[model samples]
Target: MENKKEKKQSKGRRKIEINKISKKSSLNVTFSKRRQGLFNKAGEFCVLSGAEMAIITISPGGKTFTFGHPSADAILNRHLTGNSTSGESSTNLVKGFWWDEQSIESLDLEELNQYVESMEVLRKLVALKVDEMEKGSDQSPSDFLAMDSNSLLDAFASSEAENIE
Candidate 1:
């Protein structure tokens, strides 16, 4: 006969029931952690799939927290104005860096203006990248890689700062 001893251990993972937490403190803690986890996953999704997302959540206490890939404003505005164009109709819309000439006629004046501004921003960024490449120092991996939303936003911010000064 063989005797087996049950090892004492806490449950590794448990399925959380779909129910509201009765305790305010526990709910708050769970909300905070889960919110962060959700935002982290959203960011990862955006980076991996070249997708954009915006999550606006109001806590039980009424405080609002936002997680936006690229930007909440851009995503929300695109949704509101129905400016989201995809597929072969638009060129590089995913990167927001370029658009096809054929698609230019489809845009309103505001959209055309916005596209022009985006192109200007991209031009400035390219100039900066060229300068960096010329310098051949402190070359970031992003310099040679495809521009993700974060890097693109950073480039925009830097360009805006340069313009301001």
Candidate 2:
């Protein structure tokens, strides 16, 4: 056989350990790239399925990142307001509210009233938190908890109107 020089194979991607990255700069770069990839996949799903989608992720440094087909708020409001009484109980509870599966058909008037009142309280608390965030106020969660329900509802309504416009 004729002697021939063999060329070395180029190195490709290698398996990396799943340990925490030691380098801060590398970690940040990786986070940014991965976050972009996640958003791209969500957008692709939305486009291919004609379905609305939203993603909310908090970075390791506590900064929030969000991506939505139309908007995060719009998607959230749609999900919240969508009819949930289609003969199926949701296994997952809403982010800020909890309800059990005591059939509404079985509840008496007093129980129904109590349920409605509890829901109103939860709604006010959520609205207050949303209002503070919209106003860019530096108030803590405790401060929001201390606010009156009526004022919170008013703030929340104004914010809702602004969002609609």
Candidate 3:
């Protein structure tokens, strides 16, 4: 029995062809080691090339590994798209060159436009709700009012109450 066990241990140490294993436990262990090795390689590549990248993977044991670019998601998204309209987006394509031409004025304009669009949509929704209310519908004006009034600060307290429950 000891001789057989020693032979099996020696075989296990030898590199085996990658395939689905019948033994569930062994397969899981192999997957975890390979996944860690892959992440380490990615980190090395990032360090050497000075490039932005994101590699996300879940190990066989259900552990997650994530590698991010210096700017992280913002730069990764631009590379995936293959085209960029702004300087911020273009920086990902050219390594080590970091300059964002997206000015505060443009950012402010975008924010204002988004706010206006959101407000317009909300107004339309409220008008529809008001029409529904007028027709003796189940939905109340208070519901619409609450949705508009809810803010981030209020959301935090509401979430705390939910967790307590």
Top-scoring candidate (lDDT): 1
Clashing pairs in 3: none
How big is the positional error of residue 150 in model 1, measured in Å on the Cα after superposition? 24
Which candidate would rank higher by lDDT, 2 or 3? 2
- Candidate 1 local distance difference test against the native: 0.73
Order by TM-score, highest first: 1, 2, 3
Q: Tell me the spans in candidate 2 whose CA falls farther than 4 Å from its real position.
A: 1-7, 10-14, 80-165
Residue 19, candidate 1: alpha-carbon lDDT: 91
**What value of lDDT does candidate 3 attain over all alpha carbons?**
0.60
By TM-score, the best candidate is 1
lDDT of 3 by residue, 1-165 (tens): 455544433445677687778788888768667766876787788789876577766656464555564544675677778745447635555654322433435657767675555456556555766898999985444334334335533654554466458
Report the lDDT tens digits of candidate 1 across residue range 1-165.
Answer: 659888899988999779989999999889878987998999999999988889987778776677776766667777887887534222334556444435888989987886787789989777878887889765444325423468878878886687668
- Candidate 3 residues lying further than 4 Å off, grouped into runs, are 1-16, 61-64, 84-165
- Lowest summed lDDT window (length 10), candidate 3: 95-104
